[model samples]
Target: MKVHVHVSLKPGVLDPQGRAIHHALEGLGFIGVNDVRAGRLIELDVADDTSDAALDDMCRKLLANMVIENYRIEKVAA
Candidate 1:
């Protein structure tokens, strides 16, 4: 099975990398850009029998920071 984890900063959290990207876009003459939020995608290939509970635990314990980040798990179609 293939799993994808999308991790990002939550609302009200400061994202310096996002800010930098936004600024760079503006510098490159891009317009109509309001804001940018940076995030990460993690791909995992696990056994077909892997349970949802275990995947969620992986995100909560190591993949995502419970303090100011949020994560979503996506199971890819084979």
Candidate 2:
């Protein structure tokens, strides 16, 4: 099974990198963008027997920072 994780900053947290990218886009004449948020994606191949609970634990322990970031997991066909 393939486990896909997406980690992103929670709302109201400061995102300097995302801000910088937004500014750069405006400078490049792409003014339609009102806001930008950056996040990370992690893909993992695990044994078919891996449980959803274990995957959730992985996100809480290593895949995401529970303090300021939130994560979502998706199971994809191998």
lDDT of 1 by residue, 1-78 (tens): 999999999999999999999999999999999999999999999999999999999999999999999999999998
Q: List per-candidate RMSD values in Å.
A: 0.5, 0.8
TM-scores of the candidates in the order shown:
0.97, 0.95
In model 2, which regions exceed 4 Å deviation?
A: none
Give the alpha carbon lDDT tens digit for every residue of 1-78 in model 2. Answer: 888899999999999989999999999999689899999999999999999999999999999999999999989876
CA lDDT, every model vs. true structure: 0.98, 0.94
TM-score of 2: 0.95
